[model samples]
Target: MSELSSPGGEMRLDKWLWAARFFKTRQLAIEAINGGKVQVDGQRAKPSRSIRPGSRLEIHKGSLSWTIEVLAINKQRRPATEAAGLYVEDEASREKRQEIARERRELGGQPQEGRPSKRDRRMIQRFTGRNEPSD
Candidate 1:
């Protein structure tokens, strides 16, 4: 049964994020919270902030941002699919993420070509061995 919709359940922001799979570790979630990468109900929140069911969350990571509503709270981390069920991503958020991904793909994946730097050259020389005589 889903724990979402329970009237009195509450969870810590960092714990929920870790259990929901938004972060690989609680420390990362805390860092993100402290860095202003996450907000609750349109306001910045601390890692220890309490989040109940239906709370709105805004999360920014790199070029992607997500607006999601809390659906459930699970203290123990679960499989990806189960974790996915813990929140509902807004339609606009999903569309925006998709559009960004499409643009990134269309822009081409290759980086600009440039000559190797001195450090790179030294590493290559070390790898290839400067002492090796050419045939």
Candidate 2:
């Protein structure tokens, strides 16, 4: 319960995202919003958008994505534990992330062992049916 939320029980999307520990800074949250990485109720959201409790957000960060329901709004950034209390990740989202992680692990830790040689690259391209015509 950080001193957040406007009189209407809503807070700026960027500020809420920051206070919730999603992005490291308000600037990053703003950038993400503008970059279409964040959506509210399945629609693209702006940093200035106001969000309230029970609002659903879909956030995509790199290879990880989250669908969360806002449980509370905090204006001030807090410790991880407290920040976590502000929202609950959707069950399906949680399970999907876990499955993806498990698959990555089973795929042998690092997918790329090292840079492949020219011949190796060609072989890989051919195997994948991406053979290109050589000049």
Candidate 3:
């Protein structure tokens, strides 16, 4: 067992994001906040924003953004599912992400596996809607 957490409730938004695995570390969380990758309740917020159990967060990373409702104020990092419990994802964003991933997978660099002949190896320039060959 580890040291007990403070019962005084809530933690900083930056700290909670790190603990929830939304970012790899607290520094990353801060960077995201400062870089405009985070929003709260439809408005931009600072790293020092005090987040409570039900506060909603809109987090952007890469080509994705997640809308989550905070469920707890955990300062410790945990496993994926356990960390996921810290928030509930917005359904619209989840579906959007899924569609994006699927599109990327289908239109990305991977060629379908039936069989490629020697000629395919020679002129496989237009495989994934692009002229680049898959490595």
Candidates in order, TM-scores: namely 0.78, 0.74, 0.73
Give lDDT tens digits, candidate 3, residues 4-88.
2333477888888988899998999999999989998888999999988778899999998899888776678877777777788
Q: Tens-digit lDDT track for model 1 on 1-135?
A: 354324358999999999899999999999999999999999999999999989999999999999999988786887888888888999999999999999999998867479987777777878988844346
Native-to-model Cα distance after best TM-score fit, residue 51 in candidate 1, in Å? 0.4
Using lDDT, rank the candidates from best to worst: 1, 2, 3
On TM-score, the candidate that comes out on top is 1
* Per-residue accuracy of model 2 over 1-135 as CA lDDT, tens digit each: 545533237899999999889999999999999999999999998899989988999999888899999988777788998888899998999999999889888888675578998998899889999899467
Error of 1 at 108 (Å): 3.1
Stretch of 10 with least lDDT, candidate 2: 1-10
TM-score: model 1 vs. ground truth: 0.78
**Candidate 2 Cα errors over 4 Å, as ranges:** 1-8, 108-135
Which regions in candidate 1 have their CA more than 4 angstroms from the true location? 1-8, 110-135
